[model samples]
Target: MSESGASPAKIKKLDPTEEVHETREYDPETQKALEEIDSCQNEIDQLNEKASEEILKVEQKYNKLRKPNFENRSKIIQRIPNFWVTAFVNHPQISAILEEEEEECLHYLTKLDVEEFDDIKSGYRIKFHFDENPYFENEVLTKEFHLGSTGDPASQSTDIKWKEGHNLVERFRQRMQQGEKGGTGRKRPLELRSFFSWFSDHGDPSADEIAEVIKDDMWPNPLQYFLVPDIEVENGEGDDDEEELEDEEVDDNVVVVEEEIEEVDEEGVEEEEEEEAPGEEDGEADE
Candidate 1:
């Protein structure tokens, strides 16, 4: 105890890194328990690694099995006009990046192929096959993404052979050249660019949203999106839309009719007043 009659303050506990307590206050049993917990964690990690390996084997097996069916489906899809483009536009994720120009350009996209590399975890590639159109000269455009062991993603895409005055990516470059108010345009972020331009983009590889959408969603079940318009048509949606338009027109005309009725009522009242003036004058002359 200090001379001031107060108990001496106990030594402040420091963080493990700040000051190592060679003589740990924990009991031997507690220390041994912590060691056991670490050992348990190591075992769990080993089990998780084994489970991942098993999952990978299953994925590889199913991926190969699904290949032939996918090829057959592609052949059938070719029979349908504008199948790939329609499916893409219907996709919620892909459609977000697509604009009118991209949609029109994609009309020429006859086939789309998404292939995973042998090591599925490594990465995958998306190939777009287009017919000769007013767009770029490349009939086949392929983009590949490679994810390394360290969790870093790298991607490369085919250089677009744009015809004269047909570069979509220029839209972003142009915006950058023009220099937006906040210097954001000059930053040249890939997110602002439209569809085909995105293929050329190498930035933001981790956020390759459209590729993920194609692989995880559209590749497995594209027919669902392809049949969207057909479903709407089958449900008499066209007729319903027409009826709604007609109802809106009728509502508009009703408002116009009410205005005309008010005008006529005012005119009728003015005519009645004019007739009463002659009667009043005749009565006054008689008096």
Candidate 2:
């Protein structure tokens, strides 16, 4: 205070009686309502935490059980040659879909692979690899199907293409291409829907008519056994409550600022009244 030539601010201590009077200003009913809200929130938080812990325990148990079952299945399939193919052929629904000629071609099928795209629900690819056969020169055929935004199995667009790899007979055939038919005729790329329908029905097929047959009934569900199970996620209610709390805090800050501005204005008016009182006393003395 001596360095600045200004008086130090004094802090007033409240008496015990004054503290008691201050407590009387709060309504009991209002205080109880606030306490009840806090209690309910605490209970909800505890229950949510316990539920999350239980869910995690169940998931861990499921994974522990699932791993051994998957390992056993994999070992069995490895021991059995063409195990998946044999199973598909024996299935009543699948057997009903194949014709005599198609069944003959299917028997040459050595490998089947399915690949999901970046967005799992968006699309997938089905690839068929065959052994050396007399039907065509291509060794691998791939088909990609695009799904709708609504997660419908029926695709709006389909891409079908043949990968190049010559069979033993095809290699000899390529060497003999110097004759009158030097270039072997290129096999035309078939439309995905038409090919699957013709393969399934052994009849003339159209794009629209085959869409439901291949996408909805065939590809997705039949290959589900090979895909990993999707994990389920719970919605977080705490995040919503936190956002609401942040909004309330912002409103309280605005009210505090307004109250501070009003207090400053009232202090300025009191200073002006005190300055005028001395001027009025001097005017009365001059009279």
Candidate 3:
């Protein structure tokens, strides 16, 4: 008997159905909510996989442009020599050449100005031209050497061509930010062509497409912590499935100990009652 004097009965081992009921700790609402949340997450993951694949294609296309032996059908970028200063820059006769001819021979000069070029021996003069400025020319013509990004002595050259249309990172960031701030409320089509379009020109993305990407990247669990309004989470709400997965395993020792405890309690209560019953019989006999 328990301390409250109610007779103890064996606690029936829960059957599969009963076990399911007890184990089903989550209310229906919570379960439904969690299922929905999981579905949305799966959809997002799939979208991410698709987006990543497309990004890889874009990366490959650009990567090929950086290589010399890409397939014949691929876009070819003429492999100009890596050095910034060309043979024209090093040529002995270049000192006497006209400003226009010097650039034409070099083929990579972007800027030319007269003040930089001046009178020297052999009617040669130094000039200030940005396309290939002779920054570190020796005072003597024989010792004159041009310094540039890829030159032997100068260290300022980097391959990042900051041309007029090369602001891709900035433009993508702006588009991503706009998508986050404004709820487009549209389903984006999964189109590879759209990626090509974005690559070619930094333009405003279709609101629907941006929304789809955002949906894939957004997290429901994170939203809960952020306290974002109108966000819903479903399935095993608040119950970490990780723990439930672990608890499904039971230790034989624990079950044995609990059974032993119940048995001991039953024996102790029965012996006490038996002793009390004998005393009550003796009292009646004496009376």
Candidate 4:
């Protein structure tokens, strides 16, 4: 459906000079494949949005603290601003193929460095896999630096020029952590320490190799450990119980002291009345 609520125009028949749109109707197996492709594309969209937002936030924060400079900044601070996830548009060719034949298309958008992007004519690839067989394809798009500036239409590839320093793995890990924390609406607590051990062991062959050779190697866990509220709650509960007990003791003492004072006043009043009675009798006798 179009945004105006009108039915969208269907793609016209393929031209021989243009990219061919596959027109085969899908079998049940093909439908299943298409669904998987849709799912992956949706995940890719979500990752792109999250990575962009994270990068923007880091840049905004840094902009507030220090002027943008290429030097004298710590590596961690420098790295935070590079958290952008690559964005991808599904190959129109793939879409046309799906519409025609109903086959599932499998492809992933990966962030690329300048060198990597240059190698691919921009960082995009369309890979079609059916059963165990795979076919790889490419489409080229032109890029313009400024909006409204017309460039020779000679260069447009749907491929993205991957910006340098954009780390897909780290962005993916951060995204997964967010989902694990609360993004999925399940609100599960994530322990970064456990992830650190698994990630460090599996990926860093250099570190692992060094550690294996050393007899007394103790590697620091890289995952950030945050204090949970349960420990503080337990301590607070103990203090609250003690306070309640003290309040109860103070209330009991207040009541007992009030009763003792009332009894003493009553005894003093009785003695005063008895002395007054004797004085009245002496006055009557004198009269």
lDDT score of model 3? Answer: 0.36
Summing lDDT over every window of 10 consecutive residues in candidate 1, give the lowest-scoring window: 1-10
What is the RMSD, in Å, between candidate 3 and the native fold over all Cα?
A: 34.5
Each prediction's RMSD to truth: 11.4, 32.5, 34.5, 22.7
lDDT of 1 by residue, 124-234 (tens): 999899999987899999999997587678899999988888776775467547854222212333446667767887886777877788888998899999898888888
Off-target runs (Cα >4 Å) in candidate 2 are 1-80, 150-287
RMSD of 4: 22.7
Clashes of each: 0, 0, 15, 11
Tens digits of per-residue lDDT, candidate 4, 1-287, equal 12232211222355678874654556777666765665666678779979977876775566445432312232332243221110011222112212111121122211121111222221212121112212223222222111122442122223322234433334436665775431222222233322112223334332332222111121111111112234456557558778999999999999999999999999999999999999999999999
Cα lDDT of model 3 by residue, 1-287, tens digit: 12332211222346657642333346677666756665666678779979977876775665456334323212121233312124233322221221322233234432211111122111211222233323222121111222322424211111222335433334334555675321222333333122212323323322233222222222111123223222323444555676666665456567888999999999999999999999999999999
Q: Of 1 and 2, which scores higher on TM-score?
A: 1
lDDT-sorted candidate list, best first: 1, 2, 3, 4
Candidate 1: residue pairs that collide: none
lDDT for residue 31 in candidate 2, whole number 0-100: 60
1 or 3: which has the higher TM-score? 1
Candidate scoring better on TM-score of 2 and 4? 2
Query: Which stretches of model 1 miss by more than 4 angstroms?
Result: 1-25, 171-190, 232-287
Which candidate gets the maximum TM-score versus the true structure? 1
Residue 188, candidate 2: Cα error in Å is: 29
**Candidate 3 ranges with C-alpha deviation above 4 Å:** 1-194, 205-242, 250-259
Better of 1 and 4 by TM-score: 1
Q: Per-candidate TM vs. native?
A: 0.67, 0.31, 0.21, 0.26
